[model samples]
Target: MFDRFIDYVAKVAPDKIAIRSFEGSITFAAMNRDINRLAHALLDVIDNSSEIVAVNYKQVHIHWMLLMALSRIGVASASVSSNSEIAEKEIAILQPDAIISDTLFDIDTAAKIHVLDLNWYDQAMKRFKPDPIYTLYEPDRIVRVSIAAGTSFMRHRIDYTASMIESSVIRMITQEKISWSLMSEIPRYPTLLPTLAFGSFHGFLCYLSIWSIGGTIIMADREQYFAAIAMLSPDLMVISPAQLQLIAENLPEDIPRQDHLRLIVVAGNFPNGLRHFVQQRLTKNLNVTYATSEAGVIASINIDQINHDDTAGWIMPWIDVQVVDDQDHPLTYGEIGNIRIKSPNIVQKFFQNVQDTHKQFKNGWFYPGDLGILNEEGLLRLIGRVDELYNFGGDKFYANKIDAVICSIEGIKDAALFSMPDNDGIQQPWLAIVRGGNFDIDQIARLLEKEFYNLPDVSVLWVNSIPRDEEGHVLRNHLEKLAMQYIETI
Candidate 1:
């Protein structure tokens, strides 16, 4: 479906730089040739069947090329990190026909399956030089399978169709006004620089969106991101709130301002005050995007909304968003309910899990496990997750609301609020605060009492930092375990 876009750029501007990494830059023409060679070489290792192929390589530069090659041949692809143990577990569940990586594993089942080391794969592809002709994949075929994070034992898969990938590109062009088409007056395409994991949906989409416009992607590790940005001067960037806070705290005053930069923050409810701080210091515009692995890029609010309004954003043109009740009945404006979505860009189903498919995908609408409300103007205000809504002695409340309020307090750098079971198996509200300077626990307790008059059995912990994943999501289960250990020790 997107073969035309890549081929067009290779034809029109063969010399244009497509990717820029620490190693070097590769042009559109060269990328096309390399992908063609890789696609042809892949045929020898994997069969023509629709079975998925798992790739766990250390060299991040080869991921995009491998994905394009997989798409070209009509085979679904799943990527895990270079950790052999995690790869072995995923291989057991996914049962991929081929496993491509930088090193070999010791799993007995892998002996029968084709295992192509990336170094060997590249050397072999070098043997097949010129473009190899191959049949294109159908639009409705599954091309990519993505895994969800925060699961220590189980890995859940979300399958993306070829049509869905194409639609995602179209949505980026139409909604973001980011493109290099002749109709656009903008002379240069945007360069995306992300510090997230390579296997993440956000990271993959960032690379794909840039490639769709024949733009550049600068690869950098989290520690090297700030230093690399100074040299690369990327026009587009995506980050988590944790990264934003890191920049706000440590960034030097003498760093050059990137006038062309457009920064996007994903996966959190960014307070308006912090949004202003980031825009003034880091970039010209700040976009807070609310989305999920199942439904990609649901909505994005720009600097105007970030400054003036309290909203995630109005629904994007690609999605049909609704606030529905438990019975799947549509709710009226300003009524808080489950946020359900219908979009062509969303995944059709889980790869092999029937229970998760039925739970998440229902009646053609994907419930992203979020609670929200839509105003009369169609603006979306996401409440906490329905599952995260805890009951304190018959009073229901969202933990994120408490977390946001506590984070707003003076001298509080970060906060995590959740319920933990006590000795009697009764769950109680607990607050963990990361202090920036001198913090008054008494004053915070008074504030909480003022907010909830009957609130009792509330405990507070002052920690240096909160436990979080690579994507900056709070690791609640890990935190709960730590809290239990702390309580027992005390």
Candidate 2:
């Protein structure tokens, strides 16, 4: 599969830079040689068909090359960023046969296996080059396992089989060509700014896809993302909606060529207010994408299709989407229900949690626990999480909806809404806002009163920062704990 991929790239543009990181750039030929050397080193450590291995690498290019090498060698690679001490704890629990590291790190374990240092591997590569051989692999075999950024001991397995990888490469190549074609049609360049970290699937996959097609991927830290926009003057960029909101709120008037950016691909939880803010501020459309760690990209809306503030778009050809109710009964069009999908791309099961694995799959469909409505137009609009909704005075309200409305306010930086028990021991809705100034609580209360009259008991609390998990999801449990403390103090 990799040979085929390399052949395709070689035919297109082999001498072009395939991987660029903070360290240096690697051409296609050099990257191929590196993967071959790594594969040989991996073979020396373990026989073929090794299920688990610890890949300790920080450079983005190394991660991609390692993934390809593992796929070719028929090994299930588990990658943990060097920053993760907790990941080491989980690695001890899994007890893989081999551990590959870019640098020597402290990992207290009993697994006696080869620890291939990347620096040493690179140094050795200068004097050795192996003959290229066509390697065959079982397309259905598991190739990669990615630990989730959620609670400890709960890992999300990513099984990138050969067939899945092939499909992914084809789709990405097609998308890249289409994006470039569109750029030519419009005569504009699309600049990519991906958020780093092992947990970011899109950030990892998109960068690899762009590199495979000889495109540039600009790497920047969280702060550097905004700084680059101010100084580097990119024509197009991709960012999460939350980051876009932060950029819009904190942008300076002297931002260089701010309007030059033609497109912004905003993914993850697409807050409605942030979409509106982007449209209003830049006078450009916001492209929202619905994607997941398990499944690559389910659906996406282009800038031209951002009408009615609805998630109306085509589902990716590779995805099989179904709307089902609480009882797992499939719903017809125009029905509002839970969204489930069946795709070879999604992980068949979680790494170690059998109970979650069973619960996540129903009738061979991966239930993501999101409630959505599929309209007659075949557009899917995610409402909220099935477990995140609350009933107030017999009226159902999604926490995300209230969050979007509160975050739409000019002064509010971030907001989260959840239910809490009142003095009467009845569940009441509460809104927490992370703001910069003295916000008028009474005025905000009146605004909520006018908009959400069904929510009779609404409380407001100012917080320094909204707690977020490593994957950028709002930690509702932490917010609930903080809300209880604020209630007691008041």
Candidate 3:
């Protein structure tokens, strides 16, 4: 697994920093040693009884080390979060052969499941001599299990073989234009801050990409988002769109925008009218990307290459993207339909989730269930989800059609139009908005009337912020709940 890459990086830049947290930091050389020592310690205590090991903790280095250690011993690993709202449910579904977590947390599991406290692994790894006796690679064996980032909790397990993960990592390096060289002085992303959630798939990929080249991964979870940026001076920062909004809105006036940053990659869509402000406040190198848990990197476009608003950049050369009709046939260019992605490394099916696998994975293509359009030139534009279609007496259209028009109104920071059933059980349109200081609620009605066709009377639901998942998808259920509460209050 990572041991070989670590060994290679150690050979080149052993002295360079590898992982950094508030507690401490480790160099590539020392990290390699520690991983090997931990692998040997795990080798003694671990057996084939547990099919998959779940690594659950906030200790960044420890979590990472445990993952790589399990990989070295040819045992698959799943990154489980102790703080996940459905931690117990996740553990039950995973039914992990074993769980490695902090002793302070109580994660009840079956008596058959091995639960190794991190303190014990730490002590044992320190005392035992290290032997780098690890299987270098297993192409067919599953090496990692990443939970899908859909269906609210995104609990559906997605499995990856060693080859699939390697391919995905290489694709990331290629798409991100990561420079690789033997000369250590070139400084390849020396210090990095990734704003994606720690245990998420993209976050794991971010860490691996940085460590593949022996760069510093700053686990600054304890500090405020922008505060960490000021204190660490990271050369590269990887943020999701939601995190981008938080930093853009909350950053202090005194702190200067990061113009000197080597790169700033947004892992998901950049909302309409956001690029200009983000470029002015954050780094100008805002690399926009679109990816899925089933499908790997679908498309990526550098900020400089962008030519349109609300675009998901260009589809990857290796991937085939098509907007399809209801029957799963392809739709012509510029027409919005379900986005079906086909790539070499796309996951075959969900792990232990038969219903989802049947619905999503078919004939090497993964139907992500999101509405989107592909232009003739291969540019992708994402619309809302299939379940979000507004049914106006059986004439259905994606709700984002109205949203895209509504966002044209000035001072409207963010807006999502949702379909909610009225007291009579008829579906009605409801607008949830996060207004900027200069926005006018009345203006939304006026502008929407002019641009929209036969638009229904939209009830307004004012919210301080639009609730979204880490992936930047609007949490429509939460929005509807807020809307319901607002109706009750008024």
Compare the candidates by TM-score and give the number of the best one.
Answer: 1
Error of 2 at 94 (Å): 6.9
Give the winner by TM-score: 1 or 2: 1
lDDT of 3 by residue, 332-385 (tens): 998978888888878888777788787887787888877787899988877667
lDDT of each: 0.72, 0.63, 0.73
Give one digit per residue, the lDDT tens place, for model 2 in 1-490.
4444543564467676554444555666766666776666556666754577767777655666666676556676666656759657657655566767766667677654455666666755664455454566678765555554322224455545667656665675564444334333432223455653543455556655555555555555666766666655445565665566667777666654355565545344665566666766653634556766666667766666655444635576677888987788889887878888877656666666677777777677887777787766557777767766778889988877777777766677778887788779888877778886656656667777777887867776678888765445567777789988886896
Candidate 2 TM-score to native:
0.82
Q: In model 1, what is the error at residue 58, expressed in angstroms?
A: 1.7
TM-scores, in order shown?
A: 0.89, 0.82, 0.88
Ranking by lDDT: 3, 1, 2
RMSD of each: 3.4, 4.1, 3.5
Candidate with more favorable, higher TM-score: 2 or 3: 3
Q: List model 1 lDDT by residue over 130-205, tens digit each.
A: 5655556577776767776312313576667777777776676665573222232342577788766656666677
| Regions of candidate 3 where Cα sits further than 4 Å from its true position | 21-24, 104-108, 111-122, 150-154, 178-190, 222-224, 262-268, 394-397, 401-414, 434-440, 481-490
Q: In model 3, how large is the Cα lDDT of residue 455?
A: 69
For model 3, give the 10-residue run with minimal summed lDDT. 178-187
Backbone clash count for every predicted candidate, in the order shown: 0, 0, 1
Candidate 3 lands at a TM-score of 0.88
Range of the 10 consecutive residues with the lowest summed lDDT in candidate 1: 178-187
